[model samples]
Target: MSLQHFSHQHPLVFIASHGHEIEKVNCSACGELVSGSSFGCVECGFYLHKQCVEAPAEMNHPFHRNHNLNLFTRNPYLAGTIICDFSRKTCENFVYHYSCNLDFHIKCALFSHSIAEKKNVEFQDISRIDPSINTGNVTEELKKAECFACRKPLLDSIYFSPNCGFYLHAKCVDLPAEINHLFHQEHPLFLQFNSQRLSCKICQKPQGPEFVYCCSPCKFALHIQCATIPTKINQPFHRKHPLILQSVDECLPCQICQETTNLNDFVYFCSICKFVLHIRCVSSPLIIEDKLHHEHSFTLFPRQVLYCDACGTLGNYVPYICSTCGIFVHKNCISVPRVIKFYRHQHRIPHTYFLDQNESEPWECRFCLEEVNTEHGSYFCSKCNYIVHVKCATKNSRWYYEVDSTETEEATDSDEPVDLREIHPHNLILSGDIRDFKQCHGCLLPIDTSYCYCSQCDFFLHKACAALRAKKHIWFHYCQKLLKLTSGCIFQCCMCKYFTSGFAYTCDKCKERFCLRCSLLSDMPKCEGHEHRLRRFTGESKELCRGCGTSVHAFICKPCNFNLDWNCITLPLKTQHSFDVHLLNSLITLMITIIQEVIIVIFVKRKGIPNIGFIIV
Candidate 1:
């Protein structure tokens, strides 16, 4: 006999026994196993149990009351796969779709049971743990262990599960449908699965399951893991007291790495000493095997150190020192890329742990235009004479590898001529004549060491200046922009009133010019010699250099009344003087001459010698 069924359009036939040959057949209506006598269509292979074929087409489910639920054997939305809202699992069988968006498993929609209504639900573990706890799961020992919600490992002792081996945290199972979070106080956060691939606000990283804490109205979503980070804790790095988690509303420098904390993330704050540390920095490993340098491992130190071998800055912060290589680097510096396409250079630049001191003159950085101490670590080009500071190369993200890096040759600081499209149409040849000083076009400072200059156009540039990128982001500038190098006009820098006939990064819209020296250093720098932080003083007032005693523009410590000039801070330890060509023996001869002059002048009434000037001593 043939009978019409709601699940299929074709007529169904009553099959008494299909035998054991058809070992498995499923009910199309409720998606259950079919056995014994069943109703089926031979042509379409649509089978259903006798009771399922008699079920209603539409029904009201207690869990969702806004709309009537419709049974669907196939996904109507054509989204390929759908998630069951009731069971919080991927649905492959029959589903009940409501309001054109909400989907539920057939079992959850018809035979619904809230977490509280389930008889197997346990409350023994939830009562002991703090209600507001953010992290860690209740302890459990099971052969096949899984959390009730996330289905991940539960390492702590604060979870509950219905099955003997399976478990989940009480917090995850008991999360309210909606909540008000301190980080996002403006809107109410709702618990839902993120099907839109929204990024998490706290970690700034995206890649996870569908379940998340979300604010549908604002489209703000955060991963469940980030939302559960403890608000306060005593960190192992700084263990004096509890470190409270604070939002980054303003620029606050991290005490461990000494870099400004990103405004989007949370930081551990110690209000008593104004100490702040980034979550990543606080969790840095004591010993790390850096990827770029495979020769030796680096160990972290807690005390403040002298100089950073990477950025070449004097700051108080913890450093990662490699005892085998005899080098000290900031924790953040360890993450600098081994090979980078710097905005300022045409070829790929690889980081060098040490530059050979065999060069006639010191190599200066192309971006900052500062002397690159060969004794420290820096990025160098093996193909050409190009070198840059680790921090300077990464300041802006403009210089990224657009093409395959393997196609380009390695960079080197060689004595080859370079062609600059911004400068004259001719290639500028490298000159290593220290005796002849030519004003550089970029910084407008006299180049006393190595330089690249065009004999045809009378254009000159410090080897460093010639390597400046077409576009860059300086420390003082708020945003990155294309820097145009221009000359043939007298320009005075707005920050530092220095007259420059050489080239500079010119802003035609703002009518501002910035020399290379002023662009390298930030307004606020922590100096090794000063007790308080030093601020760059640009006013045209006389300030004595604390080290050299020369009156000029200098960085000042307002509280201590101490000032240091750029020339004083960057002075080389040893220098060759014109008066003393004979090294150590010349100083002794000069002392003897001074003593004889003193004897002759004191013992005998004598006038000044012919070529000898008045002896101030």
Candidate 2:
């Protein structure tokens, strides 16, 4: 006779006895092998035990006395899987659920009810028959005996078969044989021993020889803990679209941390926008409060941007914004240093958003030698009129160090108005006015204004140059030795290779010489001919100097393709020559005229010139 059931669509036929053809059939209600009398829907491949087919829709089980357990064909929760309280495994078939977070499999609920009534049954001595069991002071032997179901130690309530050496947790003995998960919907996952040591696709963690939900054909597996992760989630930061859990083979950058995700890691992705976020970044904080960077708090702006106001570099993804300051900056730029001491400059520089504009002269960066945009942020020294790009100042750790805001800068002798007798044999007087032209003995540059002069000898030094220390450490020198200030002999500079009679910083150990101008130059030198900083040419072959057209040691401006030799770099700004009636405008022009004169003399010598003796002085 055919019987209608609420769980299945088709009418179930009563099978009075199990035959060879239906021996392997499992009950659809409890997912257990059906043995005795049962109901079968041959067309749908569905079956159920006689007791399960006659079970009531609602009942007050003794295990949960507070509420009535209602029968459910599928999980009632909107997301994630439901685990049975008795089996400790996912409930994929019919279950008895209560609104108060209690659930049980159909067979488990029936067997539990039968035991409560003291029915005649085999295996009545099972430990699970008694709800309470003493688990205190468990011996080492019992601790070593792990449950065959979950692979966890059977320290508490468990079902033990001494003759068969089979151990199972009280709650694990009735685990469902198979389950269907949201992560993999192609096939039903079966509860099996993880003998191959496969990693869970959801958490990407290696699984030991334990029970897991696995699909043999697809080689997909998931731990019981990882199988509960929801397939879709609504993150607070990304509210436009709900992110779906997905597996990716390529490394993609996470929008929150701006770091590349590991290959083959599970990520929360938005298929509609192609937005990817690392699984870890899903819980990033919405707001950050850093007192050191700014007075106001910064809120995370969860969108891609092109620029950052702090570092002035291209921003990749999300940026932090301070609404009070009306600025958008990178997350990494929030802690940028406010004041720093650069190795190239004597005074400390402070960060500023915009420089004070002098209409006559635009601000130029001392490091890159490029025009500074007054609208953007930069490092500036108001005392020395020195300014540099923010990136150039803090590019390298060895170039600068942060300075405390409250610390006072040390005063130099140049700032003081006094006569010095210790520096020279005669008292040197500081004067702003001098009638005759004088050259500084230290740097050999023209001392036009604010200089120290000695009456006993022709000793003169620029006010700033006279404040130099007796010994100093320069970063450009590889010897890492302190160079001493020495004078009185002409020597070639190791850096610029220029021969000069000016003061030199000499290293006694390596015998390396550096002229005053070369020693004072930073690693990146400023040049007037080009709009960019010049770097030393350390190539194997000599570069052709653009100034004199000679292949020699030179400094190059790569962007401009400009090169300057030492001889051209150190040429005085103004010079007096007998061949010119007025003072030569520039030493560069004088050198060019000399080159032209030599070329004319060679042409005259090759042809013939009568009594006009072409002489070059």
lDDT of each residue in 1-617, candidate 2, tens digit only: 98999998999999988899879999989888889999999999899899999899997654343457899988878888887654456788999886666677787677656543435263456434221455564567666766655566666455554332345565654555577998789998866545456788877888764667888668788876566567789865567899888887778767666566777778888767666777666666668777765678888886667666776655456778899988777665677788887766666788887666565677656665567766667788888778877777777787788888779975421334222444467878899985555667777665667998887897899988777766766656655456777776656578765545667888888999898776666556677757887766644567789878999867778667788876566565654443554354345346645664666566556666543643321
> Could you say which candidate leads in lDDT?
2
Estimate every model's Cα lDDT from 0 to 1.
0.62, 0.70
Quote model 2's TM-score: 0.41
Give the TM-scores of the predictions, in the order they appear.
0.46, 0.41
TM-score of 1: 0.46
Question: Model 1 misses residue 191 by how many Å?
Answer: 5.2
lDDT of 1 by residue, 212-266 (tens): 6777667677777667777787754455778877766767778667778776566
Instruction: Give the lDDT of residue 376 in candidate 1.
Output: 66
